[model samples]
Target: MKIKICFLLLLFAFSNSFGQQNNFNYKREIIGTNDQWHKLELPNEIFGKISPNLNDIRIIGISEQNDTLEAPYIIHSTEDQIKNVNVDFKLLNQSRDKNGYYFTFKVPTSNSINQIQLNFEQENFDWKTTLEGSQDQQNWYTLVEDYRILSINNAHTNYQFSKLNFPNANYGFYRIGIKSGEKPKLESAALFLKEIVKGKSRNYQIKKINTIENKKRKQTELDIDLGSPVLINNLKVNILESFDYYRPVHIQYVTDSTKTELGWKYNYQTLASGTLNSIEKNEFKFSNTVAQHVKIIIKNSDNEALTISNVEIGGSVYELLVRFSKPAKYFLYYGNTNARRPNYDISRFSDNIPKSITTLALGDEKIITKSETPKSEPLFADEKWLWAVMALIILILGGFTLKMIKKTDEREV
Candidate 1:
């Protein structure tokens, strides 16, 4: 493996030396930290810049084309292993939702409940409810009221949600209510608090949010540009006013549509307004979905624009698989101006190919500990020195061109 890495490095160096004036520069990147070997797609731009006209290009650690020409992506010999996380959730309560199901659950005085899981079997209809906590069952106080639980299974939309989280409260008894539904079967559900051993890696953060506040006449609108398509998880809307109220926040992504009969069509999704009774922050969290541009229409409800301050949008952390034998120097490279994104499946293992792979029981899902954004490094392999050399060469060439042009002009005179 050492021999292969050295050979690939030499080949890449050779290509770089003879590359175009712009040159093909490789750089270090920190994309993800996963236990399995993540087969990644090289930045398409790399393919166009390198030895063009060739039938194929080589990536180290990836391709083993020829014994003489090794791939640039190959690692320095590493053992491959997988990290199995034992993830299992517990069942809370399973009952039919006929004419709105409401039940009282028990919570110990010591332990705090953070997550509420639900599994629905019925296909049609939307259910909304809330939770109330109290020391005694007779005297109850609303914890989170008018909360919605939707289970949609249709051609356009298909969703099965079983988890609802809230700020942990120390309460002896908790009430669960299901509103606006009759005879909704309980498929299977579990309430679990994730507990796992921490790994020695950082989280991967890949998002760039550009926020613009537009104070409308009776409402607040924001046209947010997320630099690129990202799987956004949530956004926090900052309301500066002291008064707390619930107003629906509508979100719509820039859909690819020329024009419809009624006019330009927009695919809009909405989050029901939550009860905001404090001066603190109120958050709107969405499921994992890819969106490049987002437009937010904040319902003012007579709430002035002066009350709004700012909004914060955050994307979900992405994980990639990498198989390393030992601690070796690795780099994350991307931004191939012109190249085809390679195709490879990371989930499939050559050895353990399940014959009947229809069923899969996944455990609790949590953020795998890994580095985010990447350590302070340039986008490409460190190539600032190459720029200096190119500048000097360009200066010499420019001077030579000037001398020739002067001779021609002097002859004409």
Candidate 2:
């Protein structure tokens, strides 16, 4: 019958374009902060007012503990915060090149240096450098233009480093640009005194494995599952070749309500052995708590058990404080994907949300301030009963096309 009247007018035009749209907006911007909330900027196009109503929206996420912060400049990392500063270097002249070798140093300072630490002992690979500074070495100042120097030996690990760090200076003449000619034997070129400190922001949110029901419990314990209960420091282990030598591993976790019956309650102990700087990052750093189950007891120190590669978990990151006020324009209105995380006291900012206090984007649903919110479901979710059931389905398809034109005028009488 005309394809059921064209499929009921295309299902009432796709339910009036997705269930009679009400209205909600999303385009957020207005992320500026510092004073140690750590630079997170956008600085333009500001608009926020909350009127699509519903008690003023509040569903935030990204470890949503509330107090709406935006970003910590997407987490900075050149991996630094070095401290081995003793200072004392004076080589002053050396040059050789076919691929590498150039030196001229003197880091005699009274204070005001970015940072430098080049304790060499080559032959392993990866090098690239160029560093310059001068208080009067005839006026020069480049200070690391593409710096990278690294060395590593196998059989489990051996190391050398020079990630060429820089950014701060008073200059007492410094210059070293060894583009890896592999003649590195220069031992002491240290001048460290740099500390950036901004820790509490961990990232690595999912990894759950609870399969091993038996097989002698997968032959001696191995469960780094973290599906919930997080706040960790570090643990990135993925070994194969049967866990490449060097043993002494005993780490355990799972204690929140302290579940028993052989489930969650591993007390808590940490100890890792071998290859720290000589690298193996079998990554181990602990003491943060709130776990979902992380136990890898490979004691008896070593041997054919720590095999089967895979065990990666990471967490512990903070500093996402967003409270900007100068020429504002902020946004981050979550999609209300179910919503549940509202303990807002603006998230107790231990003192530092005053860049002159000014914010407006109060939305995350459920902030109605009273009145209207009890239509009590049904009646076609009333919009005047959805236009009276679309006018009684167009008058029952126009009374069945006028009763088929009165049966063709009674068959032409």
Tell me, by lDDT, which candidate is best.
2
Q: What TM-score do all the candidates reach, one by one?
A: 0.37, 0.35
**Considering summed lDDT, which 10 consecutive residues are worst modelled in model 2?**
43-52
The number of residue pairs in model 1 that clash at the backbone is 28
- Model 1 lDDT, residue 132, Cα: 78
Cα error, residue 46 of model 2, in Å, equals: 25
Model 2 TM-score relative to the real fold: 0.35
* Error at 111, model 1, angstroms: 10
lDDT of 2 by residue, 1-413 (tens): 78467758866795644331222233343333223333332111111233211122322222222222332122122122435455566788888868668788776666666667777655576667788888888988787775766676765445556645678766777888777645777776667657566443545545655423234423345666665555565676666663224444556775434677887654655534333222235687664444566776543322345453666666543223343322222344422223333444445643545444332223233322112111223333346676676678778877887898899899999
What candidate 2 gets wrong by more than 4 Å, as runs, is 1-3, 12-102, 105-121, 124-133, 138-150, 158-160, 170-173, 176-391, 394-396, 403-413
For candidate 2, the per-residue lDDT at 158 reads 55
Any idea what lDDT model 2 has?
0.51
* Clashes per model (N, Cα, C within 3 A): 28, 23
